[model samples]
Target: MQDSESLQIARAMRRIPRWWLIPVVVLVVLAGLGAAYWAGTSTTAGTESTPPLAAVVPVSATVERRAVVKQVVLSGKVVAGAESVLQASHAEGVDRLVVTAVAKEAGSHVAPGDLLAVVSGRPLLILPAGVPLYRDITQGEAGPDVESLQTVLTSWGYACPVTGSFDLPTQQALGFWYKAAGFKAPTASDPISQGEAGSAAPKPSSSDIMFRWREFVQVPGDTGKVASIAGSGAILADDGVVARIRVADDAIVARADVVQAEQFAVGMRVTVRAGSTALDTTVAKVSSFLEGEHSENTIPGKDITVALPPGAQGFAAGQSVTVTAGSAATESLAVPLIAIRQEGGRPYLLVQANDQKNDQANGQPRRLEVKITAQADGWAAIADVDGLLVGDEVTLQ
Candidate 1:
């Protein structure tokens, strides 16, 4: 009977379909995978290290007094300013100006009464700042030029009176000046001194000297350094320029694009740099830029001129430099541009109310209306308004 039952069980197992067994096997594997997933999720929930997200906080800045400055750096060059040219003037009975000797060369500093050159065997001296020589000043002539000469002579300790008349004392002063310059003074034309029609050369009177306008040239200013002088043998006509003078020091000239030049104005302060040296100066001038066709060799731009301040040094013409120029507003309350908000086309700021106990600003930001004086370089210069004070914190919204 046992054998018969075993055979019946075997038949029953074989009668089961293979597709049904496959379903059972799949169910068991899925159950195992679900259990593993549940265990892993529980473990991760208990030991996870990530913290919860915190509340969002707004950024803040401080309101303080400062200047809103806009600056532009440009390539520049040191150049010489306008200069005065020394020209030869016409003399009485003289047809040409012949340079015989040049006592002062280029780069020589000259002052009044200094000998500069010898022209046509006559010493050419430097006169004080005045009008140009127009005519010969005789011994008895009275004029404004004679008075100026007398004043200069008196200043040099010659003890001459400024009477505007070329008198004996003036003549004596001229003689002394000529003697000091290593030249003989010419005397007035006295026929009595011409002994018997050229029996001997006429002897100049001891107390009389005539002022010849050709012997001196008026320097344009008090003093100047000679830039260039004519050659010793160069011949020139009247009104011909003999030498050039640099009356002032070097200036810095910078070129800016037409669009960038609109911000540059005269009297603006600027910083000039060359190599490692920096100088502070003011803008002396600004040249206008006209919109037109430019030649290939010309650069289309506006020129910015900056003059060296008094006592400036270590600068030379033709040197390359960097110029920094721009505009600046006076000291006023300012804040970052991000801190400023606009509403209805009006500028406003969000300021945090201070906690009096700890001086900490932890309260809600309050909206404060402000007037923007100027804005530049990510900063807005503002005028003080109601409830706006320096040292107050502002929200960057």
Candidate 2:
């Protein structure tokens, strides 16, 4: 009608057709994003399809260091204590021995029923050689100075054999008797000088030979680290102390007069002292030095003892040691035999925590479970010390 309503108002003012204003700009951007998510500004667009967050970077550790060989300067000294042999314990009557207790002296400390030298074996002289009107075990006989006192104790070696033969070791080396015509100390004093008895009888020197050979001691402790003192044992009974003083000040004891009798034998050579050191030991039997009824068949020197190379406790028993026998025993440590790493295949070495220690202990790493066991000479002994403790410090992987 007026040009068809002016051509539909000029096509609706000619601007709305960019796809029709895209549904009014998508409904005003969904109402301004729901009013900016209800005014809480910006934070609610999760539709749950995530699973894409990764950055990974952890697995490092270390600690394995052991190398203390101060150039390896080992050391060893403390010697002397080895010797054995002694015998005799019967054939009776030959003593005036009177000693009352002296038990184990001469670098002393004794065990095995201890108690040495208590004696009185004097009673020997059974005459009839010429019906000299004499009694037995000595209640008579001692004129002709008893064969000039058994030829001055068999010229002073007293194993006695002077042929004045009335036996009993010439009545136990008879020190001074013959109070015959009665009333003591009178070798017929008819001579403060029977004219020097034709002068000539002083020939027994080494102090007239007297050693009764009895020192036998040393056997107590010390097997601290390198053990092997064998089954060891000892037994005998005729106890005696003060084994030696020598030069006649007269303290040389054990059945008095320094033992002219008291013995035992059979492979004897027992001596095992530790500290300064002394081990020349071996034993099977020996015992009897004196103990009763006119006590002469004396026997007391054993209860059990034997040792052939097995003892260590640092040592102490008159302490004087120095021993090294047969020799052979080794087991040392200090490793590094190939970066070690095998797991179940075996060959392992784990202990690198100081951050894997590329910078060693500096990388601040960690790891553990070692066990190289043995490589020897080149040095290696790690035997699984994931727990370690011998100066702890290892690393080779």
Clashing pairs in 1: none
lDDT measured at residue 254 in model 2 versus the true structure, 0 to 100? 18
* Model 1, residue 118: C-alpha shift (Å): 1.5
TM-score for each model: 0.57, 0.21
lDDT value for model 2: 0.34
Best by TM-score: 1
lDDT of each: 0.78, 0.34
Off by over 4 Å in 1: 1-68, 72-78, 87-98, 190-203, 231-241, 254-269, 273-279, 284-304, 308-322, 326-334, 337-362, 365-375, 380-393
lDDT tens digits by residue: candidate 2, 1-397: 9999999999888956558688989999999989988766444344445678787654322233443221111111222233221111222232322332332334333232233222221111111122222222231334453554456445545655655444555544432221121111112112121111122434222212211211112122210111111111122234321132211110101121113222212444434444454445443333343343344443332222233332345443333333221122244444555445576776654443432235455554334555554453445556535344444344554
How far off is residue 100 in model 1, in Å? 3.9
Model 2: CA > 4 A from native:
1-37, 44-54, 62-97, 100-104, 108-118, 121-344, 348-371, 374-397
